[model samples]
Target: MMVFTKYLEDFLMKCSTIGRNSATGRLAIGVGHESYESSHLQPSQWYGEVRELCGLANRPCTFPCTNNLSPSEAAEALNDHIASICQQLPPLDTTRLPAYLPARLIAPTVSQFQVLQKLEKTRVKRGTIPLDLPMHLIKEFAMELATPLTSIINASLQQSKCPSQWKTVFVTAIGKTQSPSSFGELRPIAITPLPSLLCESFATDWAYQDLAPSVDRRHFGNMRSSSTTHCLVSFLDFVLTHLDKRKSSVTSIFIDFKKAFDLVDHITVISKAAASMGIRECLFP
Candidate 1:
């Protein structure tokens, strides 16, 4: 466990440093909203209303605008919010994490509606029977399986061989739009082994929280407390301010990659990471 955590911390630290150096002159931002169409709405017009709605619901709203304020006012509020969140976050401890945090092992409780909604959204065989397993049963099985799984994973880590079961995944295609009958517009979703999935999910969350503070705020692809809207607003504010001050046009370029994740070479990524972190041993040995 100590070895695993140290490896992750060291790797992430190096990755963060690489990210910061790479983003020296680049602007990165996130744009997140519950609804994708919300992007079309002008921030100045709907910011206050959405903020008020979020306040009434007692949740953190990621809307970029606040109180329908002017650009300067909105910029100030956004900066203050970012600063406050950054200040309030607890510092990451690099010594060692507990071998097994029970909270991390536990699966999140979901309501029946949520479960049904997920089932509805899943693109499985027409007339497929959904699993009737209860949360308690899953939890019990996970708890019982943890010891052996951990031992296997640790052994594999030492030997550099990943367990075959962890690599198995079931792929399903879901339509991009409502009531689509064609296959071309469908998106592929991979369903992985539950235990492995849960472990990876927990590890991802831990890494994100642990490394977020040290990561460059400009690089916002996958970090905690940052969203697409936040990125968009920040960039927009900067552009507006620049134009107003210098009365000069700004050039912007957008690049979209298709199947970006599928195109990545995992071996290259792992090799680069190992090299960057100075891990001399063969990762797969």
Candidate 2:
């Protein structure tokens, strides 16, 4: 766990440095493009002086400013801030699982908790899980119930089974504010157990990264850090820019899959993906 924290801090430091440089470049470009009226308001003239007056001029200013702290200091401050926030949040109630959860769904073991901790340290994607479980609470709960949880999970796995409770999901519909009862006005989202999600994430990362390069680039679904809609828009922009420049004609087709997840056979998809990559071993194997 300490090792994970150390690595996380180091990674954040590197990210901070990259972010600072990017921000600095953007600031310069923005200043350069400013009108002559605002030319007298040079950032270097006031940014440093104001920051110094606020006691925030010290290395690692919490808020974004020109006079920023060293990467290490910024990382440390970030780590401490996260830890403090987690400490203040309510702890998870491990004594009872959620309603309708299977009896076989046991609490997590220390080792399993460790695995979850490591997985949490990895890059998280947006819109994955709804619940925000703090790392500190996760660690505390894992330690409190490690032995029994370990035994239960191991027995279930040895029997080639998973707890039915773990597979249960809750879904909610969010209205798009267009009209009350319109079919297209609601977006349904599924919320699953954090433990199940953590396990799935570990497995998904391994398979996805391995197969991503070999898969067709145009099929952007499920690719990490890539958005299908964004790609489509970018392609459209490219085509339109060139068409306008050269006065050429271009045709485009748009396809929409309604409830795509509900219609797709995931097993078949994985099998076909493996075949496409020319791999003999089953993805699950």
Candidate 3:
């Protein structure tokens, strides 16, 4: 008994000494979230594993690991690359916009029950995780976490003030080639916080439900039962039908803009989204 207690104390000490900000969740009673086989391993067996994972979250994500950059240097490189991509786009002029009826979007009220449902449905294997926190912990403690999460989400909706952490995302650069030499060659995948992502889904559903009528039926991308292939097939069918009717030569033009999303005026995006939600001036949280 004495030996076991001593070992427990030492184990706690090592886990505490890890550089991670939140170690309590990692030290839970059950096994690590990874695998069932790990459950039978002694603390010493897992100690090295946890230690290996400790500083990994903070590791510099530069391509070609040989660069041997400090975290700050890597971060600076990422910022410079991102800045180069952010071409300033002209803002949309509201003056020329056609007038539309004042339509109010009444989103369904969020409840703890609904939040719990969302939590219960969350799977641990989601590709994206919170920028800093582990998502599995929340999903594991869903019952205990639901109330607080519900309150926070409800408050955010009411005040239209989104937490800064929710808006912040980290980019993970995946190599496109066998040996990625430059940042340009790497595909950047943005990972948003689990909570922020959930909130986004809620907002999307809320806005889509109300704004569905305003959207064009032909605008099929990102909608259910629609794909780029489906759009192309439909266009081809229309062209064939027109030719059967003996119409004149059909003209088709395609334009592809480089870094289109990066060039978008985000202020315009936020203002437009907010106006659609029946709020003016302040952007959606």
| Predicted structure with the largest TM-score when compared to the true one | 3
- Which has the higher TM-score value, candidate number 1 or candidate number 3? 3
Judged by lDDT, which candidate is best?
Answer: 3
2 versus 3: better lDDT goes to? 3
Order the candidate numbers by TM-score, best to worst.
Answer: 3, 2, 1
Model 2 alpha-carbon drift over 4 Å, by segment: 1-116, 119-136, 142-160, 182-185, 228-233, 241-247, 278-285
Error of 1 at 224 (Å): 2.5
Lowest summed-lDDT stretch of 10 residues in model 1?
23-32
Give the residue spans of candidate 1 off by over 4 A. Answer: 1-134, 140-142, 179-184, 198-215, 277-285
Of 1 and 2, the candidate ahead on lDDT is: 2
Predictions in order: lDDT: 0.46, 0.50, 0.65
Model 3 gets an lDDT of 0.65
- For candidate 3, list the clashing residue pairs, or say none: none
lDDT of 2 by residue, 216-244 (tens): 76666677777978788879897888789
Q: Please provide, for model 3 over 1-285, each residue's C-alpha lDDT reduced to its tens digit, 9 standing for 90 to 100.
A: 456545655775675556235423334333346432234444454554443444222343446843788888987887678767774555456554433324243334588888888877877776765353455776778888878888888778767678987887778777776567877777778878877877777777766665676677888877867899888988998888777775556678888976667778866766665556444232233
State, as a TM-score between 0 and 1, how close model 1 is to the true structure: 0.45
What tens digits encode model 1's per-residue C-alpha lDDT throughout 36-84? 1223333332333333433422343233233457867655654454344
